[model samples]
Structure formats: C-alpha cells, structure tokens
Target: MNIIQKTDDELLEIAIPMWDDLIKYSNKGQYGKFIRNFSYNLLLGLNEVEVGKQFAKSELTRSLSPDYDVLGFIRRGEHVSCLFRVRSTKKEGEWLGRMVLGYEKGEVKIFAASVF
Candidate 1:
C-alpha cells in the first residue's frame, strides 16, 4: 500500500479529498476532524490540547480557503508528499501546504501535514 507507487491521477484521487477535509476542518478549528486521516504514529505524536490552542491562536490555520491547486507530488520511501498552493479566505496571501501520505496497517494515511 505504498502511496509512492500510485500514479498521479490515482494519488490525486486519494489525496485531494483528504486535503479538502484538512482545510475545511482546520478553518473550523475542529481538531478531531482535522486529524481524521492521520496515521497512528502521527496521532500519537500530537498533543490535542496544544493543537487546540494553536488552532485558536494561529490566524493562518483558521482562515484557509476551500480552494487550492495541487502543485505536485514527491516520493520518499513508502510515502508520497503532496504539495498545494493554498490561499486564505480572510487574508491576501497564499501558503505552501504539504501532506505526506503512506501506508499504515495496509491503509493509506497521513504521516504528516502542515502549512508553511
């Protein structure tokens, strides 16, 4: 279930919807929904309270738009990193978004995700 082996279209099929959910949940400050697709290890590494605080304070995370453009994908080991050009609904700038996908328990899951 290595996502790196998936074709661009196949990868987009899986990644885009997840990315959409990420942006949607982040904007709403819904920590649980934001991490719904995260891998077990990623979930374990996150501090829910810290994330909630950040969500409440970070202007960027709370203002993401539903629209985005897929920049491309990068492969590393069993993981595939998807890049997006994301714009803020409440601000006048764009940001680079990254979502790393890989297999966990034979299912595709997010290993890491961030807006930088």
Candidate 2:
C-alpha cells in the first residue's frame, strides 16, 4: 500500500465534501454530527487505524443498538479507502462495507463514516 501522509488542513479539505454528502442524505441529524466528529478525529490521527482494527475484531462480542463505531481508512495517492463493519447485537446479521473516494490531483475530498 502506498501510504500517503497528509497535513491536518489537507485532510480537512479532503473530508468536507464527503461530510456534506452525509449531511444531505443521513436522517440522523445531530447523530450525524457524531459521525462527522469521528471522521475528523480519524483523519487527524487522534484515532489510530490499529484501534479501528481492534473494534472491527471485537464488534461481534459487543452490543450495537445504533451506536457509532470507529472506522478505518488508508490514503493512497489521490484516493481514500474506508472500511466499515456493522454489528447488531439484537440480531445475527452483520455486514461490512468498504468505500473508495477519489479526487482530482489538487482537489480535496471529505467524508463521514461509522464502523465496528
């Protein structure tokens, strides 16, 4: 993997568009804010990828109940790849989703995501 290191400003620039999209489509309202904050925290490296991985692994043993979870992403070149694993304690159904975002060479992209 070609790991791309980004400054905080650069990460924000990349994240805003995605955040806007989530706001427009998400029905959670203020709960969506939590997702946005989580995304920013991840991009700022306040939440490490390792922690995300751990959450992914331990999700099966925990309860979900519409709560937020840490998501993980890797920046490669001009694209960002995200991993989201959804776990529901109330049921046996679990799902994992992955998304990729690409931007123009000099442009920025933003996103909000939740995972377990």
lDDT of 2 by residue, 23-111 (tens): 33332233334334343434675454554454446534234433423256667765676555555655576555344554433433343
Please name the candidate that would achieve the greatest lDDT relative to the true structure.
Answer: 1
Candidate 1 local Cα displacement, residue 67, angstroms: 1.2
lDDT of 1 by residue, 25-112 (tens): 9999988889989999999999999999999999889999888899999998989999999999888888999999999988899999
By TM-score, how accurate is candidate 1? Answer: 0.96
Per-candidate local distance difference test? 0.93, 0.46
Candidate 2 regions with alpha-carbon error over 4 angstroms: 1-3, 7-66, 87-92, 109-116
Superposed model 1: Cα runs more than 4 Å off? none
Q: What TM-score do all the candidates reach, one by one?
A: 0.96, 0.34
